[model samples]
Each structure stands twice: as C-alpha cells, then as structure tokens.
Target: MRLLLLISRLDCLDELDALICNAFRRRGWEVIFGEINAIAADDYRCFTRGLLLPGSGEPCHPGPAALGNRETYFLDECQLVWVMSPPQDYAARDIWQMLWLASKRTAFVNSIEGMMFLDTKHALGYVLPKENRVFAYTSNDFSFLWERYRQASDQWWVAKPANAGCGQNVFLLPPNGPNVRTTLQCLTGNAVVQSLLYNGEVGAFKPEYTILQKFILEVANGEKRVVVVCGEAVAWYGREGNPDDHRSNIAQGGTPKSVELHSGEVKLAESIGLKLMEHGINFVGIDMAYPYIVELNIGYPNGLYNEMLTSGVDRSDRVAELIIASFENHCSLLR
Candidate 1:
C-alpha cells in the first residue's frame, strides 16, 4: 500500500516517525513523508491517481488557496490521515482543514466531524457516555469553578485542557487545595472532577467520571497512554506526580514507567476500539483503566512513541498495520 504520513518539517527527525518508517519499510509498502514544507509543489499527482499537496510550506502547488491553503490545507486522497500533532496547536488549527477534506468526501480517519467534536473538553464531557461498559466518565462543573473542588469525593482530581496534550496544562486539584481556583481561572469551561485511581488502581475509574474522559489512564500515576491497533494495544508508562508530586505525565515532570497491558487491559481496549469503530471514530486511542475507558482520543494527540519506548512495546508494527488497513478501508474508497 502507498501511504503519506503528514507531519511538520522540523519534526522530520522525530523518533516516532523513525519507528513508523522502519515498520512500514519492513512491510514493503511505499511509505513516504509528506512534510508539508519539504515538497516543492502545492499539489502533485501521485502514482495511484491521487494528488499529494504538502500544504503551504516548502511545497508549492499551483492550486489556489481553495484548491489548497496551508491553514486550510486539504487532501482529497480520502485515505487515512493520521493526526500526530499536539492537540492544542495543530489539532485546533487543522480542524477546519480536516473539515474541508471531509466536505470533499475524503474518507479521513476518525472522520473530520468526530475529531472536531473531541477537540473541546466541554464537548467531550457533554457527549461521552457515563457507562459504556468499556468506557466510564465523570466531570465537575466550572459553575462554582474552583470552589466546587472543595467538595471533592476523591483525594485527587486532574485539571486538563479539552483539546491539549503532552501534559501541557494538566494539574492536580486536591480537595480544598490552594491552586484549584488558579487552575480553574486559567480555563474557560467546566473543571473535571474525577475519582483518583491512584496507587496502581488507576485503571478503575468511577462511572460518573465524564470530563476526565478524554484519554485512558492506566495503572495509576495516571498519565502514561496507549493506542489500540486492530484490537491490539501498545502501552506507555508515566510516573506518578513528581518524586514529590502525584501527576504521572512525563511532560509534567513525572518519569515514564513501563506499563504493559495485561489480559484485562487488552480486553478493555478491544471493547472500546469496536465501539469507536462503529461510531466511525477510526484511528483512535481510547484511554483505558483496566476494563473501562476514560476518554476517546480521536483528534491529533501526543507522546505515542515516547510512551512506547519507556514501555518496551514495539507499536510501530501496529502503526504500519493500521496504515495499510487505512489504505485499504478509507483511502481505497477515496479513489
């Protein structure tokens, strides 16, 4: 299968991309990098009767902005578009670009509409199921804002941006804590009040947890993440808080631990994957806590390969598998 992995020009040397490249090459697929800035054309026809436009960076296609604009960059191949950029910057900005692609009938991964919905924490909380068997969610209203955190039922709760990733804006809002107000003031929507699944039970989340349902938290420390490829899981480890803290997000100063998925986690992962697939949320990573899901990662996300490295799991193979599967399932339909 021929594939194009869209990414930033500077991220060309990314370790994650290297891993994916190695895996795709071993499969004998014609995998190429479509770094929007590297190519010289705004649009170039591919061997498969497909057109490749590298956005508005270095590649200069003769097409108009409507045909192709960097901010509004669009692809018509209708194949799988793997969104690997961070949720805040690329995820939000590219929302319309993706929407444009879908408006043209492109069979994008996760579908543009699904992704846009998942981009906001407020929207995620409003729509995610409270009890989907494989998934569970909870949330705290920002109505009282920080003061509501004083009524916390759990020892610790997380503060997160609805559309950001890599521990950029996550913080702990302990019951009656001092920073809860500061954190809430930094956010625009409601603050999520989730039960802390700390001390290795991070996989067990309360059924009422909704706002915290953006990504799956495994084990505990609760920041390491994983992805499922065709019912298979690739895991990543994150440290709990700091040596002095409790938030395990590596980007937040928590060290990465190796958390391999056991049978239960795998079972949970598959169940969530099937449900998401049914909803057309392909190319997704549902955050799992043992047998329940915390959130659905449908839009662009982060730390995928870094987490795999710390866990000793070779997920690049599964990435390749999904890439080929995307070529067959979505991209093929594009043609």
Candidate 2:
C-alpha cells in the first residue's frame, strides 16, 4: 500500500490542505497528517513527536507508548513526505533540515532546497527569459537603490521585500513623489539616531534588502496565477486588483475571477515547469501580468481551490493522480 506523510503548520491548515489529504485518502493511500513543530530529529532518525491525524479515524500518537496506536513509522518509512510549506524562521529551518536529511530514504514532493531557491525573487532571472522577465533590482543600501531609482526612465516603480508574499510592504513610487525618501528609508530601515544614553554614539541598523521593479501598467488590469503540477499547467485563474491598490494578491483584497489562458501563457508555464521539475519541485504557481512573469510560488503554491470554485472543475484529483504517477516512476528508476 502507498503511504504519505503530509507536513504543514497545524495552525495554518486550511480547506486546501484538507482537500489534499482527502484526495490521497480516497485513493486508498495511508496518510498521516501532523504539524512541523511536532517533528524531531535524533541523530539520523527523524520522526513526529506528538499526536498525528490518520487518513480516517481519531488522532493518536503513532508509537507503542500511545493510547490508541495502529502503526509506527519514521520519516524514512513513508513512501512520500509532502512538505507543504517552506521554512520561515529558525525553528522551521531546523525541522526542514531534518526532512532534507531524511529525503535520502523517502521522497519529498518538492525538495526543501528547491523550494527555498524558488522562494527568492532572484529565481525569476533563471526561470524566465529576459524578454519576458520583469526589470528589477535588489539592494540593502538605501542610497544605492535611490540612485538607481532616480536614474530610471520609468515614471513609476515598485519597491517590496525581496522574499515576502501577500503584497506586504509593497509600495508604488510615483515620479518625484514627495514621500519617496521616507518610503525608502522605512523599507530599508535606514533611519539613524544617537543612543539615548550619554554615550553619544550614533548607530544605524543594517538595511534589509528590497526588490525594485518597473511598475507594469498591465498589472492594473489584473494578475493571473497558473498552477503547474508534475511539469504541466493544470489550472489557471486571475486576480483583479481593487481601486485603491495595485497588487492583485487575494490576501491584499484582490478578488479571484475566471479567465481564459492565453496561448503564450500556457506555453510559458509549460516551459518553466520543465525547468522546475529538474530541481524536484513538483508543484508551483506562476504569477503573470500579460507577457511578463511577475513572480513564482513554490512553497505551497495555491489557487487550485479557487479554480475549482470558479470553473466548477475539480483538478485536485488529477493533481493527486499525476503526483502518484511521478512517485511510481521514481520508484521504478530506483528499482
């Protein structure tokens, strides 16, 4: 029988995660769901340390010491371990490291390192052709970025954190905008001040780098998200920005809508999916504004549920089938 271990933050679990778990369980696969915080590593051994939810039944600690126990398995025992989220901080990083080490014995849907690489906006350079890539620059120095922004020919630009999502801290820089300087300072945390103590020492914190990209006017129309699974585009949808905002992220109040996929967009997504597959990243979300690819999401790339809701076509089952097919192929190669 096939076995799968799904790892995600319990507190962050949503309808999507539940759908995925049900998809696997319906196919007669043994599924174990747990939080990353419950995972522990002792030397080379990695296993969950708390109660885990089974495919169908009450939650129970999966060991001999548990009250209700069926079977026990280490990280290596599962046929596939799907890490649904990327490491966000120190604690998460530790858990991810353990999973990475255990990956030698069991497969992970998207390799931890691959997701981390795609999580950074810098990956756009490697994934998309220059003609279709957004014009952008990243720097931690306020003065350096300011100089480049001033020299740019475009009347409008965007500044955002290099590795943030959900449109947090994203800003539009209008030509000669009065608050440009303050915005840059705030984004980079470059404001300097003297110590309150009598010590009279002046200190300025090291700036956090931000991504500066030419604002594409087409984004005002909307941004499209393409979900690619197993090196193929499976679902597509659009997010329209609200009147007061330029970002089309649903988390930022943008609304999801059904849209026809342009032939060029489909081709672009297929080509990019092949490259991502080579890195062991099986699931991805490609964000686009017409011809230019704005960004990519490799860590729990969403939009499948929305697509199902809007188009009334449930691709989740197809996604599960493709993933299982890929897993079987990998196993055959090893054998």
Candidate 3:
C-alpha cells in the first residue's frame, strides 16, 4: 500500500513529520511527499495511475495541465492521504475541498471538515462545557468589551487572535487598569477577547495579541498533553512553563516530563477523543489542566520526541500500526 504525506513545504521537516515518515517506511508502505497545492481533482480518478513516483525523496511538482487532464493522475495509487498542514491560503482551501470530495474513495487521517471545526478558538465554545467555555468575540469597540466584562465577575480578560494557536499574540486585560481604551482599541481590533481563566497567582505580565483565550492558572505548574490516536489515549506528557510563564506550550520554552493521568483526566481525554472521531479526526494532541481543556490540536500534534525521550517509551510504532490497521479496516469494508 502507498500513503501520501501532504505538507506545506518540503524545506522544513519537523520531528513529527520525520517520525511519521519513518514509521510508515518501517511498515513497508511507500511514502510520497508532496505539497497540497499540487493536488487536483483529476488526481483521484484512477487506481493505476500514480501522481508522482513512489518513495521519491524529492518533492512532487505536477503541472497544472497534468492536474487538469483525466489521464494525468497524482495520488491515485495511494490508499491514504495524511494532511500535515492546515489551510492558510485560498490555494490551500481549494486543495482541501478536493481532498474532502476525494475522501469518498481515499482515506484521510482527519477529514478537512473535521479540521475546520477545530481550527479556531471560537469553535471551542460549542464542544467544551459551559464552565470551560471561553467567550470569544471579534470586535474592536471598548463599549462592547466593557459590556461583556460587566456580565462576568472575573477580574481579568485575555485578548488574542481567533485563528492562531501555540499561545501567539495573547495578552491580559486587567480590571480598572489605566489606558484601558487605548489598550483595547489597539489589541482587540480584528481579534478575539475572552475572560481570563487565570488570576494574579501566576506572576507579572507580558503583552501580545493575535488570539485570545481564558488563561487557566492551573497551567502555572504545567499542562498535560495527551496524544489520542483512533479514539484512544495512547501516550501523554506534561509541559511545564518557564518560571512565572503562563504558557506551557513546548514552543514557548516549556519543559516536557512524563506524566500519569488520574481516572477523571483519562475520562476527559476519552470524551474528547470520541468527539474528535465524530468529525473523522483520528489523531490529535489534547491540552488540559485537570477538569478543563485548554486546546484541541488537530493539525500536526507535537510532543512525540519529548515524550519518548523523557519516558523512555516511544508510541510512534504503535501509532503507525494503528494507522495501517485503520487503512486495512477501510479496505475490508470496501470488499
């Protein structure tokens, strides 16, 4: 069997991508690397025609005419396509639409429709519980923000971009702070404002804003990152933030350590896995602080290398086996 690894760029290969590639190769499946923009509708037409050469370390660059021709095919030989990049442009969206339509014949690890549901922080309000919900609104007016703040008794608010992740452009809005209007106007424009989930217990403050979320104070100790594959929590690890830093993301200088989850936390992770499966998401990294989920990562979940290094246990082989089994099951259903 063959698998297509769709990524944004061939130049930058992260640890997860490398691990995934190695896993599939070890399983004796041919892995093809290609950019999403190179895919077209015609590529889904035939089973005999291959889009690009199999197991070619070089990137695939099928021409537009070749993509338009029904005789020309790419990815037609592959049984599964693993999307590694999130849609960031119109071209990417177009490719996603083609992939969605093609999913009828080809298996995708996580469908485009599922990714869209978890792409933005605003989407969290729908899936997460009421207490875990972080009210998100896109507007620059201070009056609107003030009205929303008045509705909540919380003393702090956070402003960030609705579409970003990894704690980018996140800021704290304090109650009764001087120059509130200026800060809100500058930060909340074309952004999202959420009630702060954390208190002054953490430490001093930093200013950044592109996406906003309720800062959970429990993350000061560290946050749990649970890797769920095919609706199972296969492995998990803790990410402890730097001193006084509220962001525990590994990208933000957070340290990784092996962790054991309690029954409640395991149940929570299972619940999230079920919800993700409903949307056809089979692999994900869920971030949580005990009772509350901080984020649901759908696009290329991280922490495999760190988890393996810290725990002396690598689940990549298991993940690879599951992916292959899923494909086999899919083929069996067709038969």
Candidate 4:
C-alpha cells in the first residue's frame, strides 16, 4: 500500500524527511512525497501507478507509463497521509481544507480539524488542570484579566498570541509596568494573559470570554519536550532559552539538551497522550515544565532528529511502526 507525506517543500527538512522515509522503506511500504500545491492541483492523477522509493533523487512520475488510465492513485491507492507542514496563509488553508475533506476516506496522522483546534496555544487549558489555563480575545477581556490578576495579588502577567508558536511576540507584564495599556491596545483577535506562575502559586486568570491560565516559571532552567506517537510517550529532551530570554523555544535561541523526566512527569505526559489520541492527534510534541503544560506542538515537531543526532536514540523506527499500525487498523475498519 502507498503512504503519502504531504509537505510544503523538501528542502529545509532534509534530515527529518530522510529518517521518516527510511523507516517506512525498511517496512516494505511505498512512500510518496508531494508538495501541497502539487497535490491540491490533483497532479498525481496524471502519473503512472508506481511506488516513489526513497533516496531515488527523482520526482514523482508525470506520465502514465507503468499503469495506464489510472486516475485515483492518490485518493484510492494511498491509505494514510501525514501532513508535515503548517498552513500559514489563505492558499495553504484552502489546500488544508481539501486534505481535510479527503481524510474522511483515508487515515491521517492528525486530522485537520484537530490540528486547527489544538494548534492554538490556548487549547491546552481544556485538558490541563484549571491552574494551568488562561485566555483572552479583546480589550474588554484584558480588563477582566487585569482585575482577576489584581484580586489574586499577582505581581506580574504574561501575554501571548493564542494561535502563535515558537514563543513569538510573547511579553512579560509586571503589575506596575507602564506599557500594559499600550500592549493591550496593540493586541487584536485571540490572545492570552495570565498571572506569572512561580513558587507554587495557582497562577490562573480569566478573560471576559474564553479561558485564561498561569505562566509557569519552571522555565527558568528550561522546558522538557516529550514526543508522543500514537498514544505513547516515546522520546523526550530538554530545551533552555538564551540566558537573556525567558522563553524556552528552540526557535527563540533556546538550546536542546538531554533530559530525563521524573516519574510524575512521565505519568502526566502519558495522560496527555491518551487525551491527544482521542482528538485524532496521534503524533505531537508537548512542551512542559513538570506539573504544567506550556504548549502542544502539532505541526512538524523536530526534536526527534536532534535527539537522535546527539543521543543516538533513533525513535523514528518506532514512530514509523506506529504510523503503519494505525493505518492498518483504519483500513481494516473500512473493510
């Protein structure tokens, strides 16, 4: 059977792509790699029916030479699709919608609907403990958050865009900070403002609408990244921000290091894994600061590659096996 990996392009993630491709190839599966634009344009239908083997250094066949007059190779022949890129703009969103509709008939690593829902940084509050939630959407909501912070005797707060990742545009707001009003004015659409969490404080807040949460200071050392695949917490590591910054995201100059999760931390990650499976998010990377979740990464998480390089623990084999098993189960159900 054929498995499709839908990506934006193959230039940037060469190492990661090679690992995944090799894993599936060793399992005797034909792997197809295609760009989102090409797939959205239905270009695969014009190609001959054949497996796109890994390390071949060739594009997908463009003419029907091996199998004649087959028009449904992508939709009918493929059993599973792993969407490995984020939809960053309107065109990408359209392509994602098309893939979402197609997923009704095929298995997907993480459903488009689930990705859209969980991709927002604020969605973690729904599954995490109440003390770890925070949300906001408007100026009025900021006022409500401020009032709650005041009532709780909090010293500082943090603001972040609800739909962003990699610690972009996140701000720390002290109670006496002069730019609170300006920051609130600059924010539009969905945002989250929460009391700074430190020293065992509950650190929760509320918006006039939606939910709000506390920002964990456990990040002072760094945050742990737990990679979960098909309801199992397989591999994990640590990420520390630059000395001058408080954010522990690798994109923001955070450094990755080997880490071991405590017993309680492992239990928490497994529990979150179970919940993510229920949402059809089988492959993801969860960032946490023991006892609190910082973010849930659904689109193209990359710690595994670095982890393998540094630690020599290649979890990609297990990830590929789980993906194959999930696809087999899904196909069997259809039959």
Q: What is the C-alpha lDDT of each candidate?
A: 0.49, 0.76, 0.67, 0.66
Off by over 4 Å in 3: 41-73, 131-142, 150-154, 190-214
2 versus 3: better TM-score goes to: 2
Taking the tens digit of each residue's C-alpha lDDT, what string does model 2 give over 119-175? 778889988899888788888778778888889735799999988888889999998
**CA error at residue 146 for candidate 1, angstroms:** 4.0
Give the per-residue lDDT of model 4 (tens digit) for 46-97.
2212235543333232122222132324644676777776755757667667
Candidate 1 per-residue lDDT over residues 1-335, each given as its tens digit: 44455555432335554565557656755444444333222443221112333322232211121122223223444344444433334444554453444435444445455566554455433444555332213343444434445555245666665545555666655656666675665453322233232433544333221233223334363543557654455544544556765555556676656666677666666665665565555555555454444456655444466576575666777767774675476545755
| Shift of residue 223 alpha carbon in model 4, Å | 0.5
User: Candidate order by lDDT, highest to lowest?
Assistant: 2, 3, 4, 1
Q: Candidate 4 local accuracy as lDDT?
A: 0.66
Model 3 TM-score on a 0 to 1 scale: 0.79
Q: What does each candidate score in C-alpha RMSD?
A: 10.9, 4.4, 8.9, 8.9
Worst 10 residues of 4 by lDDT: 61-70
Q: Candidate 2 — number of clashing residue pairs?
A: 0
lDDT of 3 at 110: 84
Candidate 1: how large is its RMSD?
Answer: 10.9
* Clash numbers, per candidate: 27, 0, 9, 7
Model 1 Cα shift for residue 112 (angstroms): 2.1
Q: State the displacement of the C-alpha of residue 105, model 1, in Å, after optimal TM-score superposition.
A: 5.0
